[model samples]
Target: MATEPAPISFARGAPSLDIIDTEGLRAAADRAFTTDPAGTFAYGTSVGYKPLRAWIAERHGVSENQVLVTNGSMQADAFLFETLVSAGDTVVVERPSYDRTLLSLKGRQADLRALELEEDGVNVRAFADLLAGGTDVRLAHLIPNFQNPAGYSLSGDKRRALVALAREYDVTIFEDDPYVELRFSGESQPTMLSLSTSGEVVYASSFSKTVCPGIRVGYLVGDEDLIAKIAKLATGTYISPNMVAQSIVNEFVRGGSFETSIATVKTALAERAARLADGLRAQIPDARFVDPEGGYFLWVEFPEGTDGDALFDAAAARGLAIVKGSDFLLDGAKNSIRIAYSGVTPDEIDEGVTRLAQAYASL
Candidate 1:
């Protein structure tokens, strides 16, 4: 009997556990033990820990009342749809976006209007047309920084234009920004939250990427009044979020370990991204891709005639897991593939690509 090699996954947008700060987490546990363990374990504010909220508010330059803690950023995303979207309501999204978000929106019965993604971000002209077509758009959800699956960031000009368009069309922009802090290189862009004068944008981010995945602490920031609406929804749902995790994150942020952890992951991911990009170029000369500035993805286009699904299956059979790009789109991308590089090491990336190249060759 032949045993398959353990698969090297290039699927999930997972940060490497290799560099995660276990010591900082241990320190947080210690603080929790001393500072009232029972209270830490008990139900706390649905708005999240005051200190954590305060820290996030200060970091993003919003008011504390404008921030609500969530089980994770995805839960915040769910609440956003619940608060704003009704059945058959129109929601705008990037053509190839984070699949989970698309699924969530579909679950909400949202009429998803997808804009074609460009290297700089969404196709602004197409976006304008979508707006001009007179759909009663309830939300325009996006990943403006180091976008998931696509790995493209919105330009400042486009960001301003999109926000203005949202304002013109009376659409709220839901900015899912889990990857903004992971930039290994390049200057930062202005957030949609910073651009909105009318509070048309709701910003969500998680510590799962930078700090630790299991911490499960993330937040939603908007105007105090809007945040109050979200918080009300939170109370009805789970009574409140996990206070112990909140305490741990609050302790971590206060102690200044979060940024250090971020830098560590960024360094490793940057190296892996470069390695994958180079390896693909060497091993599969026809593979088309853009090397990402940050985040876990590198979007690849196979030879025109190749079937991405077949390639994925072949790769899996060869013990290398990669996502078919069509999974991220509403229509389909039969020849497109998305490879996540941050979760695995440089060596694993090399081995994964070797298998991937072999799979592509066999196909």
Candidate 2:
């Protein structure tokens, strides 16, 4: 058998943290060892490190009591699901959504309902109709800003309406907003959590995008009582997130380098996104895609009769890798694919798109 070549991947979503300030980490570690060596090494509260919690709260314009740090946003979702979802319970999610979220709910045996996504956001009218038609929705998981696999942001009006619908239906809304700060274009939009009136939104975000994914720090902001319950669940799970990582992030934030770091990452991501988009448009004119205002992905739809899975295989055969859109959907859509531009450089973007064009040609 002929040996296969290593695949060039456009499937990663996290930032390339090679350029992050290593000196900051050293300083933070020095502070941790000098001031509270015992605390740094010992297990701490599950609610997350105090200073990190305070920093997150201040950033989001919430109180520390409203925040609960988890191992990552994925853990935060699991904790919330464990606390809120029962077997046979119904939850609404975008049609093409995060695969991990779908897996998490499926593992818990929740009835997953799909809502179609429009260019401006989730179809609010369809969602409202579902609620009106008596969909027993217990919760709705939404990615309001630069949605995964779709690369579309919910408009402010739609966001407010979605929040209102959740309030009217008396259902909790999980605003999974890990990509809100990664915007490379367009004006900022209001978060679903900010528009929600009934405190029905559980807002989650992470440092995995703007900072190093290895830090594994993410947080949930919601009703204090609900947050407290999730914190308890987290306490039982990992006891708490890594205290050393939390302290490093907290010190970075306090030293006023957090904003600078974010700016640096955003600049690089914007350049990469532009490179990917332009390369795709030039190389594959038949491919249709929405230019994402933020986030690392561009969601592309091939011409009808195109098989994304076949394209995936073809691309992989040519030493390139891309994710088929069906993987992100509860009910598979066979025509689309998600291309992530965060990890690859401009040359890689060009080469990857060129390979993808060849794949499409083969199909």
TM-score for each predicted model, relative to the true structure: 0.97, 0.95
lDDT of 2 by residue, 125-207 (tens): 98899899998999999998889878899898998898888888998999999988888689898888878766889999988
lDDT accuracy of residue 335 in candidate 2: 91
Q: Which model scores highest in lDDT?
A: 1
Over 4 Å off, model 1? 1-3, 36-39
Weakest 10 consecutive residues of candidate 1 by summed lDDT: 32-41
Backbone collision tally, model 2: 1
Cα deviation in Å at residue 92, candidate 2?
A: 0.4
What lDDT tens digits, residue by residue, belong to model 1 across residues 1-363? 288798799996787778899998999778866786765887786898777788899999988888998999999999988998988998989979999999999998989999899999999898788778877888888898888898999999999998999889888999899999888878799999999989889999999988888889889999789899989999999888998888888888788788788888888988999999999999998898877898889999877879998999999998888988998999966898999997898999999999999999988
Return the TM-score for candidate 2, rounded to 2 decimals: 0.95
